[model samples]
Target: MERNFMTTTKPFVIIGAGIAGVHAAESLRNEGYEGRIVLIDRDTQLPYDRPPLSKEYMLGESSESNIYLRSHESFNTLRIELKLGVEIVSIDAEKQIAITSDGTIIEWEKLLFTTGSRLRQLQVKGSDLEEVHYLKTLSDANNIRSKLDNVQQVVIVGAGFIGAELASSLKKLGKEVTILERMPLPLAHILGEEMGEYFLHLHQSKGVNVITGDSVVQFDGTSQVEKVLTENGRVISCQAVIVGIGVIPNTLLSDEKLDVDRGYVVNEFGETSLPNVYAAGDCAMWPYRGANIHIEHWDHAVNHGKCVAKNMINEKSAPYSAIPYFWSDQYDHRLQYFGHTKDWKSTVLRGNIEDQQFTYFYLNESDIVEAALLVNQPKNALAVRRLVKQQHPVHTDLLSNPDMSLKKVHLRANEDKVSY
Candidate 1:
């Protein structure tokens, strides 16, 4: 038997019309959900892809229409009521109603929060000056892109994926690019120090001035930023600056009644503590590998959205167990990563790093593959993903040999069962 809402006309409302929200709406309809579905967001523009905003979109290679997640006709065809430039001011969970910023009360049978995240702002002297931008939405990208023609020198205030991608794009645009990272090595937290050094060298070789172990203490200029002051007492002159330090989960809607940690706490099925409430994407921390983790990546968001939508309609859907995957494109190199591991005893290299074609495999004490990073080696992507999932023990000698394929290494079952 269907639920009570299935028999009525109450809409299934999803807050935040991002990738996750859009995917969830489509999944609901595809799963035979016949009720009214509404997707809401405070952003005035149509939902667009964010990853390209720092790359192709910034390089003037891709237009706004090309980046849009869906066209108007597509949403209309799916019967997904999209409410853009609309903000939900408050929610009455017991009453199953949400009050909008315009004082419109919308009743819903189930509520889904995919609010995503907000960029971490830089707070210091002259920070409020014009030309200091943070890229998160289409509007933010437009703001940065609009000023590129007048900008000859660009300073980026982070060495994370977005910041690095932006540096590559800006350098390609013929601007003198400078990157300021507080960490000793860029992306060391995720990619490790060795790979992080590789990125530092990659940027330096392209004529990008990368200054590590220093952070922006202040921005100097009148109405527009003309220079940046670092904590290490180094002053760098620049025409414009883009801050891509990181992002914090946008959980402003969560009240005392809702559970929230680093993000809105949700189970593997995307269920909250409250009945008929769900959360996904960057704003949700779901169970993974015996602990809850928030994976702020495009691929994870797409998968999580689809998985949650299934459980929203049918309560007995399978728990989400997809392996964590992420990719980044910088200059002419493509890096693909599969699985996640914070603790690994050894890292085995299979290919040449100096040639920029290699795969780094993270293995535990028992020689079980936990994660693998493929750089410019697209041919090994499928095999690497499968190897990580299988979690089979393999000889380091086989793994280190370039001729020994990953697919052939884990063929034999180990007498010792792998334990996490």
Candidate 2:
């Protein structure tokens, strides 16, 4: 399909108002695209950041107001129209128009689908009970917060970052927490089996009933969640059940012909197969770092938004080549992982695991693939990310030395870019 080269005076319609959509809108303005912008969201409130919802917000350390990425005044200042609480029922790509649930039809020259993703529902008996909840939106967070006082025992399904963080928060609040994961080790698929086992020890030591290699087959209750039944017939009674299985991409409104694999498939420039339509964020599946793979990290979403915005307004086309980086905060440890090490052959360990202060480096042959799972050592994470991005090979003995700073290792690379 040919790229839409003709710039129009008509408004650019963005389907969602989450992090990706908000950043895209801001980027468009920054690129001098003064054309009218219409941001449609099914949510009643303004766009907000989701990372805090499972962490500080759940702990009551941050308010909803602070969670918002942008203010309504800023949107007004930019002359961007905010249509909240209105659901787009259908999108006619042929007509270049969108029809909302309330009979509002929005005509557009170019459309950006940043609809984001929805929480995957728990598929088990008694999941319809009132006490079972899934965290995704701001409203879900508020609802979950309201029940915290009464929820003494909480059973969390899935052991991903959200589940892990939520378990920590609830445990801190004096609630008895239990996490159930179908995998043998929590986070095993993402952080490697060794690191996953380390996390298992961390949570178990914190007094959480960590159940692995079991799937919840039923939620035994009358009107509210009473007990969670595993496939092995084991029962876990709890006052509330929080499910964090994962999320599914929201691409129902896009052209059906568009190639969608897990998410809305797009080129490195964020252009879909359909003309005058683009995608970004958790909803987008685009090539990263010249590799034919899609990433769902927050940094990827924000950068994709910026790139899509630039391409939407400028004559010059830029390819998306941002490295994927993600972090998780559980208890006192701040785990930061950089790059994709799915195919790494060996992992080099630094510092003492027993002391709870260390970093792990994943290597593909002699090349540094990824690194820096910092417990208390975060400064090294920056250097490690740089080294991995630069593909600078280091001596295994030098990297293993606890006294050796990453700065010294980069300095040995004969690159003056590494400042003391």
Using TM-score as the measure, which candidate wins?
1
lDDT of 2 by residue, 170-215 (tens): 9988999999999999987877899899999999999999999999
On residues 255-325, what C-alpha lDDT tens digit does candidate 1 reach at each position?
66799998999998999888899998989988987898888999988999989999999984858988899
Please give the clash total of every predicted structure, in order: 0, 0
TM-score of each: 0.96, 0.93
Instruction: Determine the backbone clash count of candidate 2.
Output: 0
Q: Give the TM-score of candidate 1.
A: 0.96
Candidate 1, lDDT over the whole model: 0.90
lDDT (0 to 1) per candidate = 0.90, 0.84
Looking at model 1, residue 229 earns an lDDT score of 97
Model 2 alpha-carbon drift over 4 Å, by segment: 1-9, 411-420
